[model samples]
Target: MTVTNTGATPARIRLAYTLPAGLSDAGTGGCAPAGGGEHRCGEWASAPGARFSTLLRVRVDGDAWKRMPLSGSVRVTATAPGAPGVVSDDEGFAVLFPPGPPVPGIRLAADAVSFDISGGSSGLEVRLGNTGRVDAEGRVEVALPAGVTVPTPPSGCTTVSPARTRCALGTLAAGRTARLRLPVTATPEAQRQAPLAGAVLGQLDPRSGPTRQVQMSFRITSAAALATPVASPPAPTGSQGVLAAEAPAVSDGGGGGSVRRTAILLIVISTLLVVFALALATTSLRRRMTAPVAGPSAAPTE
Candidate 1:
């Protein structure tokens, strides 16, 4: 910043500067961090027509390398005495750093995915993050578990097979994330159980510790598991069994009911009479056998 006191007398001059994110105080040109990336550069008394310059230095943070949305701005505001009231101007300047490093680190996050069977499609979401300091050409290949299918793929995505899918991401900026959603279909079998899944970084250096292939359990929820259940009827009570053991009877209005009862009574009486007659004949045969003394001679008397 250059300041010239063009007024007749000496004037008090001061400047306020702001540094955007991804930048920090570099400590130069008699500048110090006032607070929150802002600096107070002057409180100088300059003579008439005296010209001087103020330099503000800043350094790019290591974390900002290759990260996206890095359009940072530096705001410069100057205040001095002028003919027309107090003179003040606020200006913004764009600062660009050389292209960030080319290394990209990928970390993946997953959510439980689900869809309807009859509808034949559901929303699929996968979150991918750039952990390195460079922008990356992002892409991912997906192979669905048994019984689920990827039928229709969107633009920039291809259905390599009934079970496999691939999607292209032009460039994923560092420290940023890409959210992917693809439509999918599930078979009846997918609703029965949850499946195991994981991801392995395939680029320059495979993240060993935290970024290593993450193995996680995921399930494709289906419609069958979500169906409502039906209720059952109640059991019969004791009063219902009072006449359940008897033969069911047919009833006619008036005279018919009376006639049926009479016929049942007569049949019971006849059965009893026949049983009594058989008992009397058995008693007579037993007595004749016990008293058979002069059986042959007595036949003459007969």
Candidate 2:
């Protein structure tokens, strides 16, 4: 009964529908403006059991398309040969929106997030911008379905519950922003080839209370190549040397061995000097015995 432009950017929606019999009138087509409201159009009927097509085209505004993902329900009605009409399918259609800005109350800028299954935690980082009238305190939570695992959220993120990870973003005033890191640790079974579904939720308080929230869902896939983590070259820790917590084997890589060798040599030289001193004392004792005293015996005989 009504047609409208429901996108942030200008868009054209073409809707074609069939009409009943004996009610078709002239000038039966028109356009719906952005943020569509009700509109009356010319009658659409001509004869008994007649079918007609009603086509509507509209240009949507650019800014409107960026507010939210566009979704709508279509209602189709059928009328009897000459009796009242009955409504048909009210199927809904949801249009896709890109992952970046212009969405209400969200700021997805300058956020670094990665997912890795190589023996460590992997998760997402999000930056939320507050544009509402009130300040916001919130976090992001992610869950993987059966057979999938999240190793850990990024640093500074904590797992508050078994399957829920929460990052507290204290308070952000209007036009200001806050950061949230969501880390997850997964079981090995979950690390195996699996698909991951994650969500980011915004809450307004530290204590348990009603939460004003926004969420987005996405998927992560792990391939065979991702079974093992590729080791990254260690970053320079920017220290004078490696800390004690690190490999101490190379503490004195060059000088330590030489110091041990010199110590062994000194021990061997000291032992040889003691042996030579003992030998000299033994030779002196033999020489004194060979030079026995005969002068004392001659003086006694006189």
Candidate that scores best on lDDT: 1
For 1-302, candidate 1 gives per-residue lDDT tens digits of: 56555444455666677665777778766566788767766467777567877666778787643232222222322233432223332333334333223333656655656555364544677666677776666666665655566677878888787766777755777777777777766655454332212121212122232322222223345544434221111211121010011111344757477888889999999999988998888898889989858755444563
Q: Per-model C-alpha lDDT, please? A: 0.51, 0.42
Question: How far in Å is the alpha carbon of 183 misplaced in model 2?
Answer: 3.1
Model 1 clash pairs are none
Q: Per-residue alpha-carbon lDDT of model 2 for 195-251, expressed as tens digits?
A: 334444454442332445555544444432244322111321211111111112244
User: Which lDDT value does model 2 have at 302?
Assistant: 38
Q: Where is model 2 more than 4 Å wrong at Cα?
A: 1-103, 106-117, 147-160, 205-211, 223-302
lDDT (Cα) of model 1: 0.51
Positional deviation of residue 39's Cα in model 1 after best superposition, in angstroms: 72
Highest TM-score model number: 1
